[model samples]
Target chain A: MLRDITIGQYFPGQSPIHKMDPRMKIIATLLYIVMLFVASHPLSLIVGIAMLVLMYRVSGIPMKMITKSLKPVVPIIIFTSVLNIFFVSGDPLFQFGFIEITRQGLMLAILMSVRILCLIAGSSLLTYTTSPIELTDAIEILLNPLKKVKVPVHELSMMMTIALRFIPTLIEETDKIMNAQKARGADMESGGLMQRAKALVPILVPLFVSSFRRADELAMAMECRCYRGGDGRTRMKQLHYSHRDWIALCIMLVSIAAVLLLNRILA
Target chain B: MAVIKTENLSHVYSEGTPFVKTAIDNISIEIEEGQMIGVIGHTGSGKSTLIQHFNGLLQPTSGKIYIDGEDMWADKSKLRDIRFKVGLVFQYPEYQLFEETCYKDIAFGPKNMGLDEGEIDRRVREAAAFVSLSEEQLMKSPFELSGGQKRRVAIAGVLAMKPKVLILDEPTAGLDPKGRDRILGQIKEYHQEEKNTVLIVSHSMEDVAKFAQKVLVMNRSKVFLYDSVENVFARAGELSQIGLAVPQITQVFMELKKRGYPVNSNVYTIEAAKKEMIRLLEKGGEVRA
Candidate 1:
């Protein structure tokens, strides 16, 4: 049942979005998130949503997957919208005991939810299009300037790549261990919260032990391969910005400017 | 009566997701009581997925699994009871060990069954003995033991539960030849002593050939063949077509038979091959260096 997590998952495709430079995708995602916040008016939000739909069409990623990514953040979305309803006071629309719902408050709540949803959807597109390894490489390259101050960019990226690679492995291991424990009559289900937490001791202890073992073995393997991080290292698949990437970056900047313009004109 | 039975059992992993895969498809099998069955398949042929269903570790996407004539999922609340009735030792089980000492690790299963302290202790020691774990070793942390010893402790943990049917998925995997033999020997002994159903999933044809009386060959998430060892090995050509082979010794015998030798191609184990050679020799067959 734990296998449902799709966070940080990439879907392989031959679409333009998938083939875009990871650095460009990351920057575009950040800009998209900024646009969501800048988009205050309903027309701006509509533009934002239309842009997302266009990107989804161009990327060839299923709409279902985009919505599925927003599932985990539903609670946060609700909490923020509820908070905005009570906190953002203006001309009252309705009133209850010690509580007032204003027209501005209601609009703020809707806009806030739209902003958060667009933020998540925009960020998730980056992950969906870029492989974890590519993302790590992009991060390392983007942070290369920090290396002048001895930031250990290569080591950080290597750690990230390794962690990403082991996630599925560790998840598979956990599933195996859980099944083994369950077969021995470990009552993981049908238990109180405390009992369930205690039941996890059997799973967590083994997972931790195996994770350490894997880390040790990985270090040894890296050493055997004569890996000396950052110094005189080269990549096989060099990151290069194509015409498509430049076009994508241009589109993102234009949309962000348009959102800001709409916010000024409408608000 | 069948101790465990499945009718049209099918399981689709990550259903409705992009990663949707039918792990096992419409599998139906009846495992009689006290039968020693070996399940053979290529990797990702749903061997692990199939055994996980026996203990209710996985619920089938469709169809039913019956344990002792009761539908396993009929009363979802009783699934835990079904697990105790059919124990499964997973591949690389040593990694599942987590207790402070080997004793506690072995006792984990019985304790989970909610057995009394005295019974749990007795079963733990008996299981330790069955796996030939020394008394001195039981007190030490499971982390302190060698890889093979850790595997034994893990197996003993399941054995401590004393399930009516025991299923092991690649139990001898990643062990040296001697260590592998020791484990297979102990499992054989356990099956004999307990006279309960034992199902072993293995890639090693020889290991399965040596222990299992009945063989179930799976290919592409479906049962390819289910028959006696001799009958299954006799169709080595069909098995090889599906990326599985008969035992190495059986292959040698089959090769000899093809070369016009009077040898039994159905012999799966070295001992059986030896007896066949002896019979040929007694019948005045010429011996060649």
Candidate 2:
């Protein structure tokens, strides 16, 4: 079950979005998130939703995967929408004994839910296209300017890369430790909150011990291969800005502009 | 009576994913009570998956696993009791040790059974003795122990549970020949004293041949052979096809047979090979003549 819970899972593809530079993808996702918050008008929201759908189509990720990613947020979406529907003050569309459903409340709730959906889908699109290695490479390059201020950008990205690489291995080790403890009759699934937290001690202690051991081994291995931090290090696969990346960034900028213009016009 | 029985058991890992794999496939077998059975297979041949099902650690994908004539998954809540009845020592079990002292670590299983303090202490001491861990050693941190000692402490933790069926995955892995023999000898002694069904999953043909009364050979997620040690080793050629081979002595006997010597190819252990050699020498010493 732990293995099934994919985090920022990548789905490989040969589409333009998949081939786009990770830096552009990261920037576009951030800009898209900002545009979602800025655009309150219904027309602008529609433009945002259309853009997300078009991007998904281009990325070629299955519709099922989009729904799968959204499944976990369904509860949050429902809770927020229900709260907005009841709390917003406006002309009452329906009234039932102190429970009033106003027109503005209904409209706001619908737009808010749609905006949340688009926000999740848009960001997930970036992770689904780019691999973790590429994402970290993009981050290091994007933060290269920060090196002038002694930010240790390369070290930070190296840490990120190592962290991401060890995530799956640690998860697997956790699973093995859990099963080993479970075989010893450690009840993990059922109990009070305190009892359950207590049950995690057996799993966590061994996991931490093994993680430290692995980290030590890895450090020694890197040293054996002449690794000395990120200084004077060269990458085997260099990041480059292709025509596709520029075109994608241009489209993202134009879409943000269109959303802003529509917001002002509708207002 | 069958202590562990599986009917059409199959386990699929990452099912419904693109990387789906059938770890074990349609394995139907029955193990009698009080038998020391050795499960041998190449890596990824499903030996570990099959043993996990015996203790109810893993639910079968499409078949039934019956422990002591009862369907293990028939009552979900009762699986805990089933786990106590079947102790599983996972591969590299030393890495699972986390307690402050070896005594506390060995007592972990019996403590989980809600036993009285006196009973837990007794079982812990008994288990420590079974693994030949000293009284002073029990007071030391398991982390401070040597690799082989830590492995024994982990094994003792499971032994303290005193399950009706004991399953160990690669129990002697990553140990010296003497350490390996000591551990397996202790396990054999434990089996003899308790008369409990024991399943040892290993890669070493010689170790299995030396201790196990029966051998369960797995190949490509299926049961290749489930027979006595002699019968299984008799088909060394088929075993090699699955990336497994008989013991070195058995291979030597097979080679002798190939070169027109009348030695038995079923010689799996050194003692058996020695006896065969003696018989060949007593037959008028043809090469000497």
Docking class of 1: high
Once model 2 is optimally superposed onto the true structure by TM-score, how far is the C-alpha of residue A67 displaced, in angstroms? 2.5
lDDT of 2 at A175: 88
- Candidate 2 structure quality by residue, lDDT tens digits, A85-171: 999999999999999999899888888888888888888888888999999999999999999999999889999999998888988
Give the Cα error of residue B159 in candidate 1, in Å. Answer: 0.8
lDDT of 2: 0.91
Clashes of each: 0, 0
- After best superposition, candidate 2 residue A246: deviation in angstroms? 2.7
- Of the candidates shown, which would achieve the greatest TM-score relative to the real structure? 1
lDDT tens per residue, model 2, B1-289: 8988999999999876556899999999999999999999989999999998998878899999888899999899899999999999999999999899999989899999999999999999999999999999999999999999999999999999999999999999999999999999999999999999999999999999999999999999999999999899888778888888889998888888888887778888889878988889888657442
Residue B140 CA displacement from its true place in model 1, Å: 1.3
DockQ of 1: 0.83
